[model samples]
Target: MMHHLLFCILLFPLSQLVCAREEAFAIVIPSSRLQCYFVPVESANHSKLIFDYQVIYGGISESEENFGLAASESYSSLTVAAETLRERLIRLRKQLDASEHFQSSRRVYETRDRMLMESKLSRVNFWSFINLVAMITVAGLQIYMVKSLFEDHSRVGQLLRRTF
Candidate 1:
C-alpha cells in the first residue's frame, strides 16, 4: 500500500490536483456589445427594430462544485499529499548536492592532470634547447681549430722556400 501511494504521488500531476480545489468563473460579454465597441452599426429601419436584453450571471457547474467539496472533505489526504511532496523535494535536493560534489572533484582531478602534463612538456623543451646549444658550440670550436692549423702549415712552407 505504501509503495502504491508513493508511486501515485510520483506519477500524479500535482498542478492539476491543486487546481482542482480552486473555483474559477469566466465573464462573457455579448457579441453585440463587442461589435458596437469596435464599430457602430447603423440601421435604416430603426423604428421597426426592437431589442430585448436580460442580465444572466454565470455560476460554477454542479459537477465542479461537487468535486471541490469532495476535495475539501478529504483534507487528510491533501495533508498526506503535501507531506509526501515535501519529502520527495528534500530527497531530490540531496541527490543534486551529491552530483554537484562529484562533478567538482572530477574537475579538480582533470586540472591536476593538465598541470602535470604541462610541466613535463616544459622540462622536455628545456633539455632539447640545452642540447642544441651545446652541439652548435662544439661545431664552432672544431671549425676554428681546423682554420688555424691550415694557416700555420702555409707559413712553414713559405719559410722553407725562402731558406733554399
Candidate 2:
C-alpha cells in the first residue's frame, strides 16, 4: 500500500506539469525627441553612437553655450584660443619627429666613433709594433755602415772591412 501511494504521488506531479510557448509584445512611440524601441536587454550597442559622438566632438556643448550669445565672427576668435585634441596631437607629433631626428644624428656620430676606435685598435696590434721597432733598428745600422765606408779612404780598406 505504501509503494502504491508513492507511485500515485509521483504520477500526480507529472500529470500537472504543462509546456508553454514564448510570446513577445512591443510598444512604439513615433517621436524623435523621445524615441524608444525594443532592444536586447543584455546589449549596449544602441547607445554606442552617443558615446562616440561625445568622444570625437567634446567641446560642442561648451561652444554652443558660450559662443551662442556672441557674434559669429567672435566665435572663431574664441575657438582659436582653445586648443583641441587634434591640435595637441599635431604638436606632439612634431616634437616626437624632432626627437627622432636628434636620436638618429646621435647614433650616426656614435657609430663613427666606434668604427674609428676599432680601426685604430686593429692597426696597432702587438705584431705591428714589433715590426716597426725592428725596421727602425735595421735602418739605423745601414746608416752607420754607410758612414764607416765613406770614412775609409782606400778601396782596399773598404774591401777588407767588407770581407771581415
Candidate 3:
C-alpha cells in the first residue's frame, strides 16, 4: 500500500508534464502571392487549413522534395522556439496587467487619504473661526459694561455738587 501511494504521487506529476509537452501549435507564413501553414505532426488532422504549396504552385521534383523536407525540419525547430516565446509573452502580459492594477489601487488609496486630510483641516479651520468670534464678542460686552459704570459715577458726583 505504501509503495502504491508513492508511485501514484510521482506518476501524477509525470503525466501532467507529458500532457503539457503534447500541446500543439500552428504557424502561418503568408506572402503576396502564396501562403503556407505549418503544424506539428500530432495536430495535422485537426488543422483548420492544410494545403500543399508544392502541389499548388507546381509539382515537386525529386530534388525539391528532399530540400523541402529539410526545410520543414528546420521550421519545426523554429516552431518550438516560437511556442516558447509565445508562452513568455503571455506571462509578461499577465505581470504587466497585475502591476497596472496595483498602481491604480495605490492611486485610489492616496486620493482617499488626501481627501480625508483635507476634510479634517477644513473642520479645524471652521471651529477656529467660531472660537475667535466668540472671544471678540465677550471682550466687547465687558468693555461696554465698564464704560457705563464710570459714566454713572460721574453723573452722581455732579448732581451732589450742584445741590451743595
Candidate 1 Cα RMSD after full superposition onto the native fold (Å): 16.1
lDDT of candidate 3 over 1-164, digit per residue (tens): 56444433332221111123355432222222333233354664544432221112322344443434577789999999999999999999999999999999999999999999999999999999999999999999788655655575666555645676
lDDT of 1 by residue, 50-120 (tens): 22222343323335444445755599888999999999999999999999999999999999999999999
Q: Per-residue lDDT tens digits of candidate 2, residues 58-101?
A: 12233354534558778786787666756998999999999999
At residue 20, candidate 3 shows an lDDT of: 32
After superposition, candidate 3 runs with Cα above 4 Å error: 1-69, 142-164
Q: What is the lDDT of residue 57 in candidate 1?
A: 36
> What TM-score does prediction 1 earn?
0.46
lDDT over C-alpha atoms for residue 147 of model 2: 72
In model 2, the runs with Cα more than 4 Å from the true position are 1-83, 126-128, 131-164
Sort by TM-score, best first. 1, 3, 2
